[model samples]
Target chain A: MGVDERRQQLIGVALELFSRRSPDEVSIDEIASAAGISRPLVYHYFPGKISLYEAALQRASDDLASRFVEPPEGPLGARLLRVMRRFFDFVDDHGPGFAALMRGGPAVGSSTTNALVDGVRQAAYLQMLSHLKIEDPPARLELVIRSWISLVESTALIWLDGRRIPRAELEVQLVHDFAALAAVSAAYDQEMAEVLRQGLKDEPGEGPFSDLVVRLVALASPPAV
Target chain B: MGVDERRQQLIGVALELFSRRSPDEVSIDEIASAAGISRPLVYHYFPGKISLYEAALQRASDDLASRFVEPPEGPLGARLLRVMRRFFDFVDDHGPGFAALMRGGPAVGSSTTNALVDGVRQAAYLQMLSHLKIEDPPARLELVIRSWISLVESTALIWLDGRRIPRAELEVQLVHDFAALAAVSAAYDQEMAEVLRQGLKDEPGEGPFSDLVVRLVALASPPAV
Candidate 1:
């Protein structure tokens, strides 16, 4: 096999082992044996077990990101619905790999692996934000972004558990829920923005956490807002 | 330690190990060593590693059930808000154990541990149903229940990840989201209930995956409904 082919094969075998057992449970020797390759060959393609796991995880994360990161052309809500549908479809098709990433596969534990996933997640969040036309304070916008991310991740996990519900129907409900949450958060963001614009100085009235909340919110949105 | 005390200690130590590494990585010897007991004594409390792991898992499941199962008397939305608050608080306080249960710890595979978690989750679902005054058909009620569960679980996981927001703020937003979802589902349930009550003859034209939607909705209510 070519170098890339051999590398792909190793990741496939590693993922199979990871799905069947925890990352720590499977040994490099066993992975090598199962792949029908010498241990040193396995080492040549990847530095070690952790490296192999990171490769697999990055592949899955990238696949998901590539599939869902397009900017929606029409209404923001419609675009979001499309994104939700794509995500649900990905989880259904790639159950084991998605499960491993979500369940914190060895790759997710490493700072490098986490950075990749976090990068994708942030990119997706920015895409969602790009579709919004809300005039809200920065703090409220951050909450909206965080809430939307949570909703998608949480919904996907439940669907993966194989509840008796059909995938299509669940997706519809999720899309609706996402719309409702966005509406509420948008309203709250506007309220906060107005408060800040009015020069409601952080006085002794609000408490220390109030400033923290304002700062976090400011960090979440575009500079123009 | 007495047999029961020793068993509890073993389970505790096993859970700690399971938290750090998958079940297969931690041997009975390691658990015994950590607990300052003999391997034979550890085996004496439980037959093998799997049994010990299950025992620890069951204990964690029981702890969550005990904390959230007993409903406070009030409107369905209010009761649900209270439950959501307590649930988030429990998870925040017992981060490792709860995270393991939700995300599937190393002691067992995702499938097995998820089934255990599902059992506790179903019980909680039933408890939530006890609070609702469903005016919908049995099937529609089930969908509402499933949707509500989805909303709460998704919101909680977001908080669990320790994002920028404080837990208290997340908890408050969750309660609001829960109420909004419950209100929407409750309305949908009533609409479906009315349709069913008028007999299947006058049923509205079915949409894509409507039957599955109806089934999921009904799964949340009492079987008799």
Candidate 2:
């Protein structure tokens, strides 16, 4: 097999082992044995155990990122919903692998992994923010995005664990939930902006508090609404 | 120190170490040294590294569970809001430790940690069910609880990470977001019930599709107004 093919095969085997056991439990020997190759062959492709685990994690993270990175053109809400649906579907199908990644995959400690996951999360959030027509400051946008992703990951895991509701139904429920959360976030942002504007005038140099108020005010003002 | 005091001390030290580094990287010897005890003494308190890690995790989990296991006292929505606020507060204060546990603390596999996390999640859901004046089947209630927990956990983590919103303001946002999620879930559940009622007249078999429809219908029904 070519280098790329061999590398891919190693990752597939690593994933299989990761799925069957904890990341820390799986040994390099086990991965090699499972892949029907010698330990040296496995080492040839990856530098170490951490690298192998990260490679497997990156593969799953990349798959998920690719699914929603450039969402197809459509209504913002609909497009966001599609991305969520795809995410939930991926989680359901690749239960163990996806769970490992979201639950802080070994790659989590690696800046590369953080960037990959954060990039995907930011893209989805941007889509939602654009749809809402709210131009929040970067920090506020970060809060909204992080909050939304946490909700998605938590909800998806619950559904994946077979909580009596089927995946399809849960997906619909999540879309609605996401919409509601977005609306609440928008309204709260607006309310905070008003409060900040009123409170800041009385205290000009409140340091971080003033900075926070400014961000809220900027976020609260809707775009051309 | 008394048994309880020593135990708590161990948990604290374990959390500190776990948060700073991966479980595998930290040894019992390190935990012992950090706690100002010998390795053998550490072993006396807990069987091994894994046991110590699990105990630490259980401590954190127990702390959160104690506040939430039983539904808070008040009106349904008010009680839920209170519990959720406390939940967020807990996450905000104990984020690093909570993150460590959720990300699989030493000795605990992701699946095992996930199951523990899900247990706390389910408990919160039960609390919500008890507080809400819903008259749905237990199964349907389960779905709502699951969805609500998912929403709260996701949103809370964002706030926990020191987002632009002040912690106090983030708590208020969560209250609004959760109230909105509960409202939507109730409405969606009601709509599903209506669909089920309409479809039951046309289909009478107990096949997979019929079972799925029945389950969805039950899950979708809203709490009694």
Candidate 3:
């Protein structure tokens, strides 16, 4: 393999190892053996274990960030649901790795790892804004968006614990969560209200947001006798 | 000072120092000077910097957990607002320390520190259930409560950055966020819906939940041409 191909292959092997166990627990010799290369060759591509680990993380980060990328098509709720599904797919595929990276494993204070994590968040935020098609979101809109992002993150992290809630339900619920968060903000700010109005304009009756409204109305009605 | 009192004083000094700077940056000498004691005395009370940091974190964790404690009286929104106020107060008082602890500082993988943080979350969760008067929460309701708690945590962490938005608004918004989270779940789960119904029974027109409902209604109205 070419140098670039060889480097990518090493990162792939390292990420697979890191996914099953924390980065610190994985050894250099193990990576070399797994990659079907010598330990010195592993060092030839990267300076040290930390460097190799970071390369793996960078690739993982890029893969995770790409999960948030959805075309600005269809209803906003449907779009968000798709994004949530993909996000969880990544979490599901890379459970331990995702948790370790999120929980700050041994690479805890490493600025590079931290930046990669934050980059994913920033990318997700910007992607959401693009979905909203809002050039300059109001402060309240930003808060709502950022808060929803954090909710999605914590939800995924917790979901990984026992796989307690069905992944499908959480995906739909998360989309509803976005609407719920924005609706609350819309109530307070006209800009947000306008944003919500635009967002719901194209939503169908079967969309997550519509389902949420139906559920809420059912809840508001007097209990069955 | 007596041994226990001296230990308390040292923890206080260390927490104060850690609040301003990362625990790793705050040396034993600084802690000793801050406590008006010698390095040996600091060591005498605690074996090492890590132990002392854990003690300080334990204290902070307890303090944080206590902020979630509120009487199970009056409107739930009012109770939650009070809780949010106290929570932000703690965040304001210990900005860097809270961020470091949450973001995973040098003490990242320390099981003791991780337990303390999780303990605080569990305590807050139980406190919320007590406030709701729910002995057994359905899985959906559990998700709502846990998700809200995570929302509150991330909100505070983000707010601490520049505190760009007014603190007072965020506090009130958080209470609304809780109602919104529960309201969304209530739409789907009868158990959660009943919980919301009970929560809203005594809420006044001026309460956060009521305010959220009013805002949502206003947004739902046909926009003026």
Q: For each candidate, what's the DockQ?
A: 0.07, 0.17, 0.58
Question: What TM-scores do the predictions have?
Answer: 0.58, 0.65, 0.92
Query: Which segments of model 1 are wrong by more than 4 Å?
Result: A5-57, A72-74, A89-123, A130-147, A153-172, A184-225, B9-54, B71-73, B100-112, B133-154, B160-169, B183-225
Model 2: residue B146 alpha-carbon error in angstroms: 2.2
Looking at model 3, give its docking quality level: medium
Relative to the unseen true structure, what is the Cα RMSD of model 3? 2.3
Q: Model 3 over residues A1-225: C-alpha lDDT tens digits?
A: 999999999999999998887666889999999999999999999999999988998998999999889989988888888899999888888888787777665553376887788899899999999998987877777788888998998888878878867999888888888888888777877777788899889988786777777778677667789
User: Distance (Å) between predicted and true CA of A170, model 2?
Assistant: 3.8
Q: What fraction of the genuine interface contacts, i.e. the true contacts, does candidate 2 reproduce?
A: 0.32
* Interface RMSD (Å), every candidate: 12.0, 11.1, 2.0
- Model 3 residue A197 distance off true place after TM-score fit, in angstroms: 2.4
Ranking by TM-score: 3, 2, 1
Q: Estimate, for each residue in B78-170, the C-alpha lDDT of model 3 and write its tens digit.
A: 998899999999999988888877777555346688778889999999999999898887777778888888899888888887787889988
Off by over 4 Å in 3: A22-25, A107-109, B107-109
Give the candidate number with the greatest lDDT: 3
